[model samples]
Target: MPTRPLSNEVLQKTIDVYIASMRSWTDSAKKLGIARSTLEHRLKVAKRRGMLGPMPKALDGFEVKEYSEQIGKNGEVKSRSTKYSPEGGGQFEVPDGYKIKGESVLTDADGQIRARWVKTKEGEEDPLQVASVVRGAFEGFVAKSPNIWRLKDHDEDSLTVYPLADFHLGMFAWSKETEGPDWDLKIAERVLTETFQELVERAPKSRKAVILGLGDLMHADSHKNQTPGSGNIMDVDTRYQKVLPKLCDIIIQCTEFVRHKHAEVEAEFKAGNHDPASTVAIRTGLDLYYRNDKHMTVNTSPSPFWWHGFGVNMLCGTHGDGAKIKDLPGIMASYKREMWGSSKSCHAFTGHVHHELCTEKDGTRVYSLRAPIPSDAWHSAEGYLSGRSMYGFHFHKDKGSTGRSEVEIL
Candidate 1:
């Protein structure tokens, strides 16, 4: 007989498991043996029929609360319970059609948030649109909008901790000859600065923000093993000067920008396989592969592959060498099982894989960043291709405590 059709309950449960397992629409489709677009269509159908729910249930443990302002009750807000996103973020819409950016609010007696209302240039509100707007607001889940203001000011203890990974700077790219000669470093600096500036724009306005430098800051020399002869192999000192400086400069500017913004903001860095192999080279008789002065936190061998402490929980700077994309979630689960001795979700920023991707592994979010490389080499495909595309992460400060983070393309 043909395979039995799935029951509604079974289908729903299967959908949840499928989503949790894949952590992304494209990967889910691929593993389920369906086309990515086709899988997307099926998911839409499921959502429309109301046979679906947020995988693992979005915002599961967080309670919703309300906060109202005394000024015309002007700044009104709703927020997700603090237990949920750590950031205590919430969403909202103006019923009176008032102009608004982001709001800073506190939880009310009821389990709802009273948003701090802000006046707009000229605007009107429709209650019908308010519910959806509010839902998206609290979660950093924004769609299209005509206007938005950056919101800030919250207690550090009241913020959420997140990982900003997927920065790829240390790789070289042969130009289609874009800028004049020796433009890669310049291009890298520009993009990195732009990204840092954007991050500064988003920092939370509450407490001192804690950061995890995740990994893959540079393309490192590992890729040299991937594509031989496509590039040159220089002495460690020469290559270090070529690529390391650009990355170090970006970090210096980043921390400097942070210091400019907040005196107490703390930033931490980690090493990944994408970093120079010499970073991990063992001194087996006097041969050293690479060495970094004091630029990165985990610059020496026995690289700090993982960082765990304080409220930050865990940090993984591994370059994701020899790991399959589809299997990341399981691998992370195992990492907790073996390495950390705890099951808290692991947040890792891995590089070497250029594609932009995200997945829920065990409990953590594993993001494969789109690097900020200035070469045409990574642009090639099975067919024909030219030009380049790159991206990076910007962790915007919220208040004095936690901050909001975003992804920007360069």
Candidate 2:
């Protein structure tokens, strides 16, 4: 009898192929020509790596303003500013480096005091120290949110990539349900829009963007004719109408933000297993947009990610769906041989798995993004242990890679 390769070879091949199509063992085994038990063994490793996540950081405090004070010679009409004095309140006189040429400055917030004197003896403690104290009732006033998207005051020019993978718009969850109806297009729009705003806020300094989508756009269950379970989402026409407008709206908002920093902003849409219909639909939608007043060329499907006049040497992509998740590497390698069949390099992004991955094959960097769903917790139903910390990435010549900020809805 012919012998199969070593255990390691099969294991590696198994890990490479799995994707949205075969998230579970039964599906994976059937596709890979392996026994369900063998597939299960290989997948134990996939599940392990899929669970990688970043350590959580404590929330940052929001600075709030409350009380107002005036500081100066009385007739001069000096405004005393009250601020938070983290150190403590003391009779420290203000010193020479006066930002404002005022007689004195007083900023007092409830728990801290900040006062600086413009004119002072050269040998005195710096007056900037005095401005920290704040005097006011730290009560009743609603403070800002503590959740921040990105580092405060980080000015670095970096190209980041965000993969919006496998948002099967016209699809609904079979088992997962959330705040409202599962797969309700209306609720999904709100959630996705809010997430985009938060992601942009998280990395405001990001200059260039690689926005790609992992397929399964329509939830047309290519693997199986999914029975209409509790959340069986398949109202194609209505769902498309609801989702299409919202997607364009979200894309427009993200594009507006992208154009502000990165001159070369492009979005790519890779088809997924579920939404083969989306290929035709999204293109039509973009065509309508272009024919309208905007007059901007908003590229659409068949090409997943937008190159945005970046470079033709490398083709940008989205949702790399061909086989099950356990067999992605094998599937991708097959694509390299059977499809691309070239010695050139490319960059691609895919979503379907609802997890984050960064791997280099041949020369292309295939970024499998981490999806942010309200029900990311429900992946337990898939018999896998994946975390929801994956965001997007940015490529830079100097820094190598940056910008994979977590998506948030706050």
Candidate 3:
């Protein structure tokens, strides 16, 4: 006699009933009229298909109430009990396009284990797969125009570059200890917007504008609220949920502002010591937002150094944490010889120190722009007090940098 081929539907239905019964695998197998070996084999298949997660721990005599969280429109959690089985088992509806990974314990402030529930979120997909899907989805939407605006030959055409460095959008600081201006998501957004708006107003009208993110746009890289490399605890304003969208919105607003003033806008982002992964997330979100916009392009390359060229000017930028300032000119030339060979003037804008400083080496001027953000506790306690300001530079087509504008925060 040969064994019958397993039906996934039948196996899934049996597993559910077995789970609801809150019986051990052996007892469930006997009740389902199947051998323990057969039952285990089917369960493994279900696991591979993502139809099942890790088995719940035995509760023994303790009361087990299984419930699912009903999130409101505002994302507030509302608990709703689906089953009150003493042996502990519940079936929760997994939303479409998402799957439950596994259960994790929810702990309280007193270091006591509170509860355990399945963690459900978007199903894991390969990055390349996601990119391909996104490309296919927007293939028809993207216009054929590579350059929307006509390039005219002019002797005085200028491009303005604004370096928005170390915004640390979700960082928190108090007025009590540091005694400086309080810093939080709200203040960060307002100051950044106002300062950029002021810079745009002062800068001469240009054909193109580059909104350069000098990294550390996020204060914390992980849910632990710590820096990426050192794991030092950081002051955070709120959960990643609220912070991400706010940062994206701020970037969108700034891009739109520059778009209105210039024919083209290019936004370049660099990874910071504080936010290696989050910076990529920010770029992905922004790319999706501006997918169909012909006038704007978002560059989210993982490379630490990037350069943009216009006529005789080459403007290279980095986060300034990876390589020293003295080696940047050589690095830029090595990485982008075509760009370096074509341009007569080379400049590097770096932003890790969060203060305005300028130095020249080997005919390449390296400028570090000031961040308008206030000092956090660690920085203030170390007496690293530096004047906060924003900067924008005007580069001429043939004459290199024509002028620069500064907006110091009072």
Best-matching candidate per TM-score: 3
Per-residue CA lDDT of model 2 for 344-391, tens digit only, reads 434555666766677876555666665554342234444543344435
TM-score of each: 0.42, 0.45, 0.62
| Best-to-worst TM-score order | 3, 2, 1
Clashes of 2: 72
Q: What are the per-residue Cα lDDT tens digits for candidate 1 across 210-233?
A: 344545565554535332324544
lDDT of each: 0.45, 0.49, 0.77
lDDT, model 1: 0.45
Error of 1 at 138 (Å): 41
TM-score of candidate 2 versus the correct structure, residues matched by position: 0.45
Q: Candidate 2 — worst ten consecutive residues by lDDT sum?
A: 51-60
lDDT of 3 by residue, 1-410 (tens): 11233455776776786797684788778888988777776775454333453333223322224435687899986644443233223344678768887776655553333455767889888799889989999976944222223335422478999887888888999989787998888888888877776676666778888988888888887678988898898889999778878988888777766776677789888888988898899889988998899989988788887789999999899898888989999998899999999998999998889877899988999988777788899999999887888888889989898879899998
Q: Candidate 3: list runs displaced more than 4 Å.
A: 1-156
Quote the positional error of residue 228 for candidate 2 in Å.
14
- Candidate 1, 59: how far from true, in Å? 99
